[model samples]
Target: MWSAEDVARDSVRRQGDGLPLTAVGERVAEAAVREQEAAERALVGGTFSEYEAEPERVAGIWAAKHVEWRRVRDLMAQCSWSRYEPDRDVQGSEWARSRAERRQAVLSGHAADLVRRQDERDELRAELWLSAGPSRLIRVAADRADLRPVEVLAQLAERVVVGEDGRVSVPPFSPSR
Candidate 1:
């Protein structure tokens, strides 16, 4: 059984454009999604009790709520009067009303906390994506300098300066010939 930490980390790693992962990263990401899907199924079956404390279970619950949210949102988006709540047999303005009610129910209760956490996670992920560029640069530069990436990054941190005029002053790269 994949742990919650594994799912969360792999899920975050799978995000972002142009950030290619190693083969292992790819495998882990695929496994994480599969775990989430299994959790979702368990949630539907009321068999998720054993994993209630797991963060991955929460994420899976959020995923399930998201599916419902989308369906309700789509119903609200439709302009047709022919649209009806198939399950509730609601029609006309009542259909829209029913959708709104269902949307609130789907987004409320524990799901509201999940939404907040998801928002914070998204903000952090954005920051991580922004840093990925510089991290990649550090890796390439470190490789060329025959030094560890952390050493290269630390040297830059200590020596690289930003001027008031917005010019960057990097210590001269004197690669051994």
Candidate 2:
């Protein structure tokens, strides 16, 4: 079982990001924002084509999912520990054995959930390298409260210069120039 201090530390580290809140999630979100900003700068400065920018946008989606996965993992660990520890002390009782069996089933389900989350995380990570240029890489779900991948790409698109040759580029200088 997790100690009170462990739980407390986790809560404080979360810094107001809500339920299943995790410190890792907060850090990932910050990093994603920084990367997104860098990608935007590159796009506006003609340093990055839309093809190059797609991964940066997909990164935000990856960050959000990463956080969610870690949260699920943390919860699963605590639940498994709590279930096992009490049963350990009362091992000889028939009631304890029955309860342990039920708990084991639940823990097995939670373990499966953890595996699924890990698979999702890995898929998102793979997307960073496999994305096809000029095509959207990820679909943002409505429930997500993290960085808006589509909006970020759309903002960059507004500054793109498309020529008659069908090539997309940025102006040599900002309109102010």
Candidate 3:
């Protein structure tokens, strides 16, 4: 069976956005709702535990996923509720509106942090996920330019076909078939 670390790494790759979206409770609640929706969409497995055997790894991955969902939920909530209706502006109301906008701007920055955090988590998840499953050698991007392909590929099998096997093959989900 694949380990939780593998799954966690795969998810990490998807999240490039920063994090720490915790703010007012109402926003938190709305965020939670959004999170549930996203999680529902993401459910290939019944629960994250389906990905791993170890209890601690499962817990860590779940907690990480939860944080990611919560951040997304709050970001959506902020976008939906931040603006006021047009054409109803008194001096006092205008001032309040401006204040609210400022608050949201600051909050948006916070949301960005949360997004970034999610990305961080995504990075971890992506790695874990990749390790747990099979992979094809797509393309290699290395920091050092002079090194030949052999340095990265290391094995003769990595040249053509990808996945756990050395032979060329297509992914099951690929639509070419």
Candidate 4:
């Protein structure tokens, strides 16, 4: 089983491994949707609990949520910097100081709006991470195979449980509280 913290660390590793953060997030979201649908199908057929017992499904759900959080977090960072770009460019131009002042005022208002958007994005990203769960059921349907080893490791930093004696146990799947 993979814990939320593990998933977050894996996302950072993936970001460092050269895959664009947004792309990784998108992929995870897509996979989550797919797995959710599969779980739903199993539920309809009355075999959902059995499916949920698979460790891979739990790992996948954790990974998907983590990646999504990272992606949105990164986007907020980009917005913060990009929003100031125009203002910087305008300031560096040869326009008269008076004209620059007027433009700067307008840009300042735009920057405020950008800040609000960033805040909203941050809230949504937090919600996504905090509310992370596999929709429908806890299982992966038969429509797809298990996640790749690299993908799993990228999303899960460590085993869910490591005892003082170094005994590791895979945690059972459970719905998010």
The model with the greatest lDDT is: 1
Ranking by TM-score: 4, 3, 1, 2
| Preferred candidate (lDDT higher): 1 or 4 | 1
Q: What TM-score fits each model?
A: 0.21, 0.20, 0.23, 0.26
What is the per-residue lDDT of model 3 for residues 94-131, given as tens digits with 9 covering 90 to 100? 44456567668889999999999989986522122233
lDDT by residue (tens digit), candidate 1, 1-177: 333433443333233112222433443455557557776775566444656554447666445434433333344345332332333323323544555575578668569799888898865221223278888887788788888876665566567789999999887764321
State how far residue 90 of model 4 sits from its true place (Å). Answer: 32
Over 4 Å off, model 1: 1-130, 162-168, 174-177
**Poorest stretch of ten by lDDT in candidate 1:** 12-21
2 against 4, candidate with superior TM-score? 4
Q: Would you give me the overall lDDT of model 3?
A: 0.43
lDDT of each: 0.51, 0.45, 0.43, 0.46
What's the CA RMSD for each of the models? 22.5, 26.9, 21.7, 30.0
lDDT of 2: 0.45
Q: Which pairs of residues collide in model 4?
A: none
Stretches of model 2 off by over 4 angstroms after superposition: 1-92, 125-177
Give one digit per residue, the lDDT tens place, for model 4 in 43-77.
Answer: 55533464454445544554555554454446436
Question: Which structure is stronger by TM-score: 1 or 2?
Answer: 1
